[model samples]
Target: MTSTIARPAPDATRRQDSAKPRRETRLRALDGLRLVAALMVAAYHYGGRGGAVTEAWGSSPKVQFPTLHAFFSYGCLGVQIFFVISGFVICMSGWGRPLRSFFASRASRLLPAYWAAVLLVTAVFALPVVAYEAVSPSDALVNLTMLQQPLGVDRVLGVCWTLWAEIRFYALFALCVVLPGANRRRVILFCALWMLAAAIAQGVDEPLLDLVLMPQYAPFFVGGIGLYLVHRDRRDAYAWGIVGVSWLIGQHYVVRELWRAPSPDAFSNRTSLGIVLVVTLGFVAVAAIALGWLNRLNWRWLTVAGALTYPFYLVHEHLGWVVIHALHRGLGLASAETFVLTVVSMLLLAWLLHRCVEKPLTPRLRAALSRTR
Candidate 1:
């Protein structure tokens, strides 16, 4: 009798083991940071500039929370922070994993809560109570694909635009780096080429390139990639160089954003330094964690907080507005009271979604996706 066991070629095995760090290990501090970024976005929508629903508060959001709203204007940068973290997390997680596995992991993480939110928002808006645009069935179906942004179909939830960017980054990473079996050299090349293409996209004003390259956001992602490399100690100088260049370009884009896309009036007067500083601080924070400067951030509760971030982000914007509209307008709650309650209620809902839908379904989806050829 004889038995045979398949084995990878020695070189293939070496490449698989090339990454120095335990790539699958969790960084608890990053979970904490993810929670923070999600809250910042929630604050921005619920209390910041305050006009998301156009009189949802019954008066200007600025007039209601005057002092806090001023600071909250900068909360919009939370998305930028998420992008940076995504770059680091995606690169770290995808390393040495096959493209199919990466896709399964991402699809499992993203689709569950997203699908729930899309249909949930559509059903909520179906009542015709909110002042916002209605979500038709066709729109809901398109949005479920998470490609509604590129397809020019209106989002069932306003925040889906961010998902579009994230999925694009995932696609770019999957096709360009993960597909080839991510390692130090390939990731380094990916970030470098992205930066070069971003510059060309911006300089030439090419819409398609801008759309694909995401010139406005490329640096944060690039910087995150560089940070992952730094953590791996692949080549400290080269990694730092990528991080530095990313921030430098990131700074330039932040400054240009004022001219490129004028913000709502509440944010118009915010200093460019404020915007640049917040974004710069994101890079600095990720870099610090990568360099082991913030290792004491390993609190256990942060994992729970991180678990809620996605579902929280998915369900917050429109649903929160509906809450605000009802509390402030229908029930006649004071603006501040409504704000506090809306935030709390959203968290509770997020927790429910995380517990019921996301938690139970993620593994099943992962397993199903894993079985796919």
Candidate 2:
């Protein structure tokens, strides 16, 4: 589809959509949401005390950003927001495609920039740029698999831990739900089975079970799939039930993680309440987009934002931190100025990755893979 479509006349389109939901139509607002989620993560990494940026900043980042740190501290939860969005989008994309096409689509979208980012981060840090030690060669090779987490190898860059989660989620969704055909009953079944498995995994306290099942994150992904059903199936009761069940499980996990985290941001009823609010709002936002509440948000810029999101996220963390450190420490730029310049540079780098690497290679990659099927 073209990037921009004129908004169809509201009354007739809305009436028809209300009567019969459009399964194939794009949810434009989700693009904007993805961009917001990525920025939230960048905010957390840059402004919170979690990363090397703290060393460069001299004092606590909370001291530097003051008012902003309170909000940014919770921003790592943006990864949860991304998991929800991935569920909705992956289901939408994979619905009718064959197994080969589904995998081709996923690999093409995921791997090109991923390879680039892994290499970029590895090479950049191999220099004496930061105080960080470079990743070992063997570790870097394993990282290329994106299964480093399960294989007991450390991540070579920031934000990669989530990629392993996404990889596993894709495997389960492809093998069980998507390839077999995604109807309401089957999607709901997957959710039910996953919920049960996750509960068992959590109770057993086995590392293998927890890694394979991902008890903490299964809820958000399942909830997103449920929301996609609601979006496509006109307020499906089974789908809504799935969403509700996921929210209940997800709420418990959110609160537990917040309370137990061994960080400065840990353990306040108020912090848990704030995180719950954000997670709830993310789900509600998707629901609104699903229910046609956001049908008016058909702007094109969001489409561009969506295109940039994956590349931006993959490359942002380490590269941006180095930028922050160099600008502030080596160049003697002030904190505020350094922050803006670093963010802008990261955006430019993301755009270049998209325009130069992804645009050129993704189609060829997909075509080559699909040929095997």
TM-score of every prediction relative to native: 0.91, 0.89
How much lDDT does each candidate structure score? 0.83, 0.82
Per-residue lDDT of model 1, residues 58-133, tens digit only: 7777777877876776777889889999999999889878877899999999999999988888888878666776
Quickly count the clashes in candidate 2.
0
Global CA lDDT computed for model 2: 0.82
lDDT of 2 by residue, 217-262 (tens): 9999999999888876654688889889988889889888865544
Model 2 residue 116 CA deviation in Å: 0.4
Return model 2's CA RMSD, one decimal.
5.7
Clashes of each: 0, 0
